[model samples]
Target: MKLQQRLIRLSVGVLLLGLILHVALLLGYEQLTYRDRALQDLRGRAQILALNSAAALAFNDTRAATENLQTLRTAPAVVLGCLYAEEATLLAHYSPSGARCPKRPQPAQGAGSIRHVESVMVQDQSVGQLLLEERLPTLAERLPRYGLLLLSVIAAEAVLILVLVVALRRRVLIPVHDLAELAARVTERRDYSQRVSTHGSDEIAALGMAVNRMLCAIEEREAAIKENAHLLQALIDHAPAAITMKTMDGRYLLANQQFAEQLGVSTEAVIGLQDIDLFPTPIAQARDQADRAAAQAEGSLRVEEQLGERVWLSERFPLRNAASEIYAVSAIATDITEQRATQASLAQALANLTQLNETLEARVAQRTFELKQAMDQLVQSEKLAALGSLVAGIAHELNTPVGMVVTTSSTMSERARELKAMVEGGSISRSKLTEFLEDLGAGMSLIENNSLRAGRLINDFKQVAVDQTSMRRRQFDLGALIDDTLHALVPLFKHSGQRIESSIGPQIACDSYPGAIEQIVTNLIQNALLHGLAGRKDGLIELGAHVSHGTVQLTLRDDGKGIETQYLPHIFDPFFTTQLGAGGSGLGLYICHNLARGILGGKIEASNHPLGGATFVLTFPAVAPQRASDAS
Candidate 1:
């Protein structure tokens, strides 16, 4: 900008000087041309005067010559005119109306006026001389016009100069100044992004382009440096170990994300903080000593640091400056708390294992005895569960009969009381006596029938417990025994919306454990009632028995929802029940399986009937496998 200002001042001064010289030269040339025109006119007039005066001089007519010279009065500024004889004498002279005329050729002091001399000849003889003086106007008279003209010229040149100066400033000075400013800014601020727009093929433009190239190189280097810094920071932040760098005095200079997290603070907060600011005094002192030692040694030092419940394998190292002097210390910490705990746990577990090995046999024997007791209890529970079902059926079956018997006995007692009252009143008529007798007989019959039904239900249910507890065998008719067992389980289906049907041969008898047979029958019936009959409105339970070859073939089936296909294989598995968490103990079918196979020596298999529903078939020797041990 300063250079541009200097250029403008210098250009203006030179232009003004040139303009002044041009105006002066124009004025001088105009004055010179004016003088020449005046001279030419005066000479022409003098020649004419001399021509006229020649005739006068030849006759010595001075009066006529003077009269001719007076003709100069017709022109302005012809201040003086003279016509003289060639003998160094003035023959005639004329003057303007109020001006003096020079008689001879007077030497002019300057160009303010013009003087010319002429001679006349008559017939090639010198006759006389003619002299004229024309006075030029004074400088004062032309000064205003000159001054106005000069001003006009100067004004035009001023405009031209202004235009040229503006063009130069825009196209040259401004761009140069901008380039200089840009260079200063880039150098001072290290900002290499600014550019100067150079339009023309000039030196300044080339300089701008060179600066742009330099800026490009600088920017590239800056970008590469920033990228490398970012990558280094990223690596430190993502490292698994906690990393930190601190001044030799233990003031933190850098802390990666992991270290910040380990210290339970933000990365920004960790910076500039001494170890004492973040940790307990003892821990901080220990850490600070480690850092100082590492820096003094100019090498790495591995130290184990216990911070609260955590253990860290801290590798403290020194960071050096360009002068190879230790400036800071860095630490990379790997956590080993969990590893140490695991190692201790593994050692303790090995010790416990050795101790257990020494007493394994005794534990096994105790566990075996406990298992035997549990099995016995489980069997007892199963028997109790079957008895529970039997009791439920008996209670249901006996409800109707006991209620009838009570009603009939009450009616009979009421009738006998009425007869006794009539006899005491001595008004018992024959028809009344007959009506009372009839009512009593009908009540007696109802009581007898219902009592017998209740007795039969009780007898059947009582047999259930007897058969389960006593492993007695009998040559009982299979059909009668099944009927009796089915009768016992009748109350279970009475309100269950199921039909219990039986198909048996009358002579089919079994010498097997009746108790086991009873148990198997009760379990199957209970299973059908509880599982197959669940959620069913109407169902059918069919019991079939026969003697085939030397074995008694018994089958029970229900036309209820069958067991699921997936559960069919495990339907009889001990402790596996589809109705788990409900009321089912999962022991009914297992006990049935055990009793049939283990006690009755029978192979009982269950399957889904082709039609639908679950079917169980029991095939046992007609004479049980241990007749002597199970005889009734």
Candidate 2:
């Protein structure tokens, strides 16, 4: 409801609440008053009857006492009348014609009725006692008349409350409402001249006066705001760094002198021009995208792009209004090409190569270090991809047996239900029972066998996956690692429509890093698939290992195209790829070479097999030579 209605309701509700409380108090007093009156009437009647009945009691005339009690018939409230002789002997009893009276009347009858017992007196000598009872009015009998009176009083009070409400609305509410309207108008027009009448010392009038003062303050702020605009323009022109602003669509809104100098344009020519009009095609496109990203960003964004021949680093942020809506994007850019030459900030910020500001010797050192780190990351990525591929293959292998167990379990449950129904219905036969038991046995056997297969595949894959990913060095059975690696390669073979076999047994053991060996083996298999078995389904890979003295030499040969004579020497060099840009990273063999030497303390040689395709033989100790890191 509106304030007008709310105030009026409050006025009327207060009056009604007061009237209800007053009526409740009045009714409570009236109840006690009526009860007291009943008791007084009963007492007075009892005293009169006692004096009249004393004669009959002293004369021993019960008939005379009965005649005297008959006087109570005139009082309709009386329900019982009794007379007792001085010796506590009943002399007479009286009630209404059809009403019954108890022989022993209680002295106290509580709230419903008033019972009075009086002793008869004859010349200061007591003769007998008289008992009288009168009924008190119930709430039902009393409310009708009381409620009628309350309604009349409530009607009067409602009329008075409405008059008061109307007066309050004009004096207090009207001024408050006028102040609100004035505030709204001043806000809409931003005009300080508008004011509400403040002709009283009331709170509402004071509020109107405060609003007028606020308008004056706002007018003063407008002058300050205009002054600040000029200050901002001067700051922008004198700014140390180049500053520019553009809309989300790339139309320039502002540009400082430094910005114009870099663009080789005047300040006037720079405004209203898009990035494409100022920079080269590629540079303009990149900066334009950066502008759009800044406008859409929640806060500041960093952009690096080359302008002309110098690289510039820009910090761009959005200009938002009161509603947090982006109206434009602003950027402050600094030429960082020279900066990168003197400092390592670019390397720190981007975690990338930094050789711009270095001396020739230092530049070469930094570049070489960065290349090494990049190579390591690339090799790690390749290793992870291989591991992931193996995981996918092992997961595929587990799905088959797990799926079989699920299907077989469901079938067994249904068969058991059918067998239960047969027995329950007394229709089970010897043949059917035997067949059911045999089928259950077969299902249990199938479930158990497949469960074990899934478990074994998981356990085997876990060892390989953990070893490859963690890169932790430990002792492992060379034969078992080779078996697991080859088993994991089965999926790769199936996918490529090739075959791989291993002749090594579990007798030969290696204490070297199996993880390194696994990667080398995987890379060789994949290399064979890419080059030797690219399109041939009959491709075969033969893996053989043997121990000599204290060294274990493993050989992997594939029945595919052999390496070309010219590229054979460079095959294991970093970034050496005969199939460049043909889905080959060129770092696989390089990674294998690094792991063999640096990690395993061994060497790997790549050559074309004389009898068939390509061959890779990796030779390392049964127990690996101490690594430089471990030795240090």
Q: Per-prediction RMSD in angstroms? A: 45.3, 35.9
Q: Which ranges in model 1 have alpha carbons more than 4 Å from their true place?
A: 1-172, 187-191, 345-632
Q: Which ten residues in a row have the lowest lDDT in candidate 2?
A: 349-358
The Cα local distance difference test for each model comes to 0.67, 0.68
Candidate of highest lDDT: 2
Off by over 4 Å in 2: 1-470, 628-632
Candidate 2 local lDDT, 1-632, one digit each (tens): 34335454554444454566567665776676777777876876676466446547756787877887787776777888988874566888878855555565457867678788877765466766788888777977866535533433444566655765576778776875776577446545656677678875755565466556645644565567668887997898888779998876788999998898876778889889998888778878888788888877788998877776786778999998535678889999877665445234312422211121123235334433543454344446755564543443344445545555666666656666675565444344558767766665665566565555555444444444322322446788888998876654443354456888889888897777776687678778878888877879888899998998988899999988888899988988666776777856566787677667766767899888888799999988899876533432
Error of 1 at 52 (Å): 95
Compared with the true structure, model 2 gives a TM-score of 0.28
Separately for all candidates shown, the number of backbone clashes (residues 3 or more apart, or on different chains) is 1, 2
Candidate 1 lDDT at 489 equals 44
Error of 1 at 65 (Å): 99
For candidate 2, the per-residue lDDT at 112 reads 79
